[model samples]
Target: MGSKQSKDKRTKEQKQLTPEAVQVTHSNQGPRTRSRHLSLVLLGVVEVPPHVWELLELQRLNLSQNCLSTLPPALGQLEHIVVLNLSGNRLTCLPKEIGRLRNLKILFANMNALTAVPEELSLCGKLEVLSLSHNLLEELPVSLNDLAFLRKLNLGSNRIAHIPLCVFSMKCLDFLHVGSNRLENIAETIQYLQNLQILIVEYNNIHALPKTLCSVTALELLNVDHNCIQALPDDLYKLSRLRKIAMHPMDTGLHIIHNPLARPLPQMLDAGLDALFRYLKDKDGNIY
Candidate 1:
């Protein structure tokens, strides 16, 4: 009886931690900015209530963790919005009027049913962070590159087979995550994004990384875990800023454990970083 009770209690606790377990209403949803920042999260809202659009002063709107299947075109009325969170919903597409919010700087629409994003979204030129992970998107519109100021983009857990061509043109991008997709190889044009700091393309069909990847001198983290990679560039040391691979804050690092590595990489084992530094000196005729 005691063991059964404990198991039941643990299951109940786990359910409570998920977003769907908590029910809320628009008025009770807490907001850091009161009327200016309204968070209707975890609400069973099927549609934006007509009253929400009236809050024209809203600057940060969070409608995440809801049951919304479609957005009313009225979403464009909130021109003052700077941050918008629409994750954990059933949305198939966003209203084209989203472009009217020229001041928007951040948008999160992950864990949705979205098949595509409206091209007008590119009009939000000030956008700095955009996350659309776990969607059904196979490719993004070329207009995506118009967000010149975008610094972080997360497209993980999607069906993308190729890194969008627009991505290489984003000169200011610092963090790019395209893991858990169908990518068989990365484009050599990846070197064009000189400002890229993080490149994660794990759980794909990549056979070998391009030597030009070594030209990404600013990369600080490269995660190619669970891929078919057999060898890395002999000049990998050129990535002077690389600090770790698959080094997550939540767990101890798990780098290339599934890759059938070649030569020195396999021997590095317990001393991957140290071996990397030593290999650099041996090739460049300078000891580090």
Candidate 2:
């Protein structure tokens, strides 16, 4: 009888969970080995079963692509969870209980109906990646500054009118995506993200790129298509690592302001960043 219980425990620990399939311990049964990972995606999972909270040993949980409108507050009970994926759901707000996942490192709630994020989320001090793209968020709480390790932030396709001041403090940030929003300008404070590599602000109403933006020499990819940018900063060529620049294909009216008048943005983009850099280099106030 004890051998049979051991076999059942191994089976429960090794088997991949289906949407409706999970091994739960009965009240009459002794303790069972807790599962470390579970994925229950693409189902009408409006409510999570109470037994889920019993898995205190769970390290990763994938509840993506479900019809869940409400996340159970009991989620906080899974203190060992390091990755929580609630993407493609209908959740309008994350429960404050989420703060209990002190071990969490990655949180993805993209493609949701989230209008506001709970300040309690700031308690996840170890979070390195936070993706909340394709939501209705209009503003972010300044408390998020506590996530000192955050490396990537995806808030694209939201209704936010401006970049929050707290975002400028994320010193380790590598990628920032705020595309298809209502931003009018990027703060000069962006220069603080010295580790930044990619900056995407496409399809916004921005009229100009800040001259200070040229300080991010680590920038590799810059997308600003469909904005009203009429010129490039004279020092934009300082981003020596820039390999690609995405802009409105028809933005031929844009020009660079420097000695002897630099090339038009569209003309240089067509010529490639390499060619653009060469032009800027050769014309460094030495040539007419």
Candidate 3:
């Protein structure tokens, strides 16, 4: 009987030392140690402890695969955090205080239940990658244009129908994924993305391609598959740097007419054609 009692006590003690238990303890830690960096708490839901406010020096935090329903306002106390992953959570909204993280660089919040993003997120001036895929967002804050250092943005599988013009003005943006939305048209202002290299707008309701798209001189990969596009502008052949262009099979057979006197375009066109054809063939094979 005494051995059984002792075993029960030991089991209870072991359960109390779990990471969740540790988090419960750390949450109560005072603000004195708020400057410590690198906190990870994955696979379980736990509220942010009040003690986390003391870790002002934190640079990375991963709380993925948890049942967290909301972020603590005290998260703003981590002024030095550079990478934050909160994916696979039950969060429905973000605290406005997140804007205080001026040094943050990468933010992953995919597979959440977010309905809207706070405009305060635009305040992360150093953010480079922002992933918000598989959410329920219908629109983005116009202030997102203020992210001068942003490079990659993913908004796949959302209910968004229209993109704001301000989104096209991000000068440093290189990659943009807007697949599986309800968009019927792309803003003409997209021509201003001079630095963009890859643009994926597949599986939308788009009906036509904007002629101004040719102005994106640095574009290399453009995916517009499964859309209603029936033709392409002849001027598309002018993009001397394009390497791949993915489109529906019905949109093929359109060739570029280059001015031999201006510059060489055949080499780049050949490479792009090869890549596009390969993609089409692969897609066709899957359809059968």
User: What is the lDDT of every predicted structure here?
Assistant: 0.82, 0.79, 0.72
Model 3 lDDT per residue over 56-151, tens place: 656677777877899988889888888888888888988999999999899999899999999999999999999998899899999988999889
User: What lDDT would candidate 3 get against the real structure?
Assistant: 0.72
Across 1-288, the per-residue lDDT of candidate 1 in tens digits comes to: 999998997686555434443233344556543445677777566777677787777778888998999998899999988999999999999999999999899999999989999999999999999999999988898998899999999999999999999898889998899999999999999988889877888898999988888888888777888899887776777776765444563332335668888777777644776576577557667665
Where does candidate 2 stray beyond 4 Å? Answer: 1-35, 244-263, 278-288
Model 2: worst 10 consecutive residues (lDDT sum): 252-261
Which residue pairs in candidate 3 collide?
27-49, 34-54, 34-55, 34-56, 35-55, 35-56, 35-57
Residue clash pairs of candidate 1: none
Predicted structure 3, TM vs. truth: 0.73
Can you give the lDDT of residue 247 in candidate 1?
53
User: Any runs in candidate 1 off by more than 4 Å, and if so which?
Assistant: 1-35, 244-254, 280-288
Instruction: Please give the RMSD to the true structure for each candidate, in Å.
Output: 7.3, 8.8, 10.0
RMSD of 2: 8.8
The pairs that clash in candidate 2 are none
Q: Model 3 off-target regions past 4 Å?
A: 1-41, 244-288
Worst 10 residues of 1 by lDDT: 245-254
- Please report the candidate that would top TM-score against the real structure: 1
